[model samples]
Target: MSLANIFDTAASAMSANTVRLNTTASNLANAESAASSIDETYRARHPVFAAVRQQVEALSFDTLDAGQTETQGVQVLGIVESDAPLQQRYEPDHPLANEEGYVFYPNVNAVEEMTNMISSSKAYQMNVEVMNSAKTMMQRLLTLGQ
Candidate 1:
């Protein structure tokens, strides 16, 4: 793949990771929220990603008629809420308790969210490194003429 394509792929991956980090932050922020009803409770959200591909023209003169497909980058399809059951607690004294003295909490798992945050951060860093490496390679190539 060309260096320009490398930059594009890394940028797309970084964008997707940003979305992941945002969703994780949202889930963590609502982890402790309480609601009187199930419908009012927050649900853990996660972003969906898919590979993006594009057709490229054949570079070789021998197979100019043939087309090639390459992965451009990752794309965020959408955010989805977890289907796992919410936490129901019997907190009769709680202000948001329902008629049954139950308060509903989000399905968000703090440990899981924290882990996801760390993973997303690492992925972003890796992309940055990839871009930097590409830049250095391009610079070195330019210096070869001197």
Candidate 2:
């Protein structure tokens, strides 16, 4: 890989982390949400990430010499809802309760979501630091001739 590609890699990682954080926030926001039925209840959402790779070719005397591999970065495959069972509570007096006196709550766990948020934030910060370090290195390289 090249020094310039570091920025792209870090940027992609930051974007992926942003998606993760957004999904975690969404899950947390709906953690306490109630629904009349299990099907209607909001489920915790998670982002899936995939790595992208690029093939690089080296040339010698205008002829292809060898191949090299480069990582482009991470991509969000998709957001998936958790399959865990929803919370079922019996509340006959609740207005949204079903005919059977039951209410469904999302399967989101606050502690898990909070941990995900923290990890995502930390990963994003690390990516930012990487980008800044790359910039500093590039600047230093520019001063080498002086």
Candidate 3:
């Protein structure tokens, strides 16, 4: 509703996008990693964001009190691992292969991860733009007063 709220929302989005990009990078880096067992395999990770609400309403002269207020920012609840099945490679000649001639690969999808990284990076940049625009507008308002 206010300029401050827009800034807050953009900042929170940028933070969440940062986490997304970091996790995507990690997943892409381990996409080709080979593991002897499923336990050692890497799983794709993602962050969960939750909306925060105002607990108490502030008293004001003109503005009426709203019982529930939705904040413009979000908080990361936690990171979750992908539960998809692991990749099974038939590498009988490979030394790391198990007795059954099977090697376990990580569940990371390199292409998907790369795409996610790009999207997150763009989202972060967009948020930066939002912040810059807000700052410029505020500066222009100061000039109006002068």
Best by TM-score: 1
**6-65 per-residue lDDT for model 1 (tens digits):** 998999999999999999999999999999999999999999999998866556557657
**In model 3, which range of ten residues has the least summed lDDT?**
52-61
Clashing residue pairs in all predictions, respectively, total 0, 0, 0
Residue 134 shift from truth in candidate 1, angstroms: 0.2
lDDT string, candidate 2, 8-71, tens digits = 8999999999999999989988888889987788999999999988766544456666646465
Q: Residue 109 CA error for candidate 3 (Å)?
A: 1.2
Scored by lDDT, model 2 comes in at 0.90
Candidate order by TM-score, decreasing, is 1, 2, 3
Q: Report per-prediction Cα RMSD to one decimal.
A: 2.9, 2.9, 3.1
Q: List the residue pairs that clash in candidate 1.
A: none
Single out the weakest 10-residue window by summed lDDT for candidate 2.
58-67
Each model's TM-score?
Answer: 0.90, 0.89, 0.85
Off by over 4 Å in 3: 55-70
Positional deviation of 20 in candidate 1, in angstroms?
A: 0.4
Tell me the TM-score of model 1. 0.90
TM-score of 3: 0.85
What is the C-alpha local distance difference test score of each model? 0.94, 0.90, 0.83
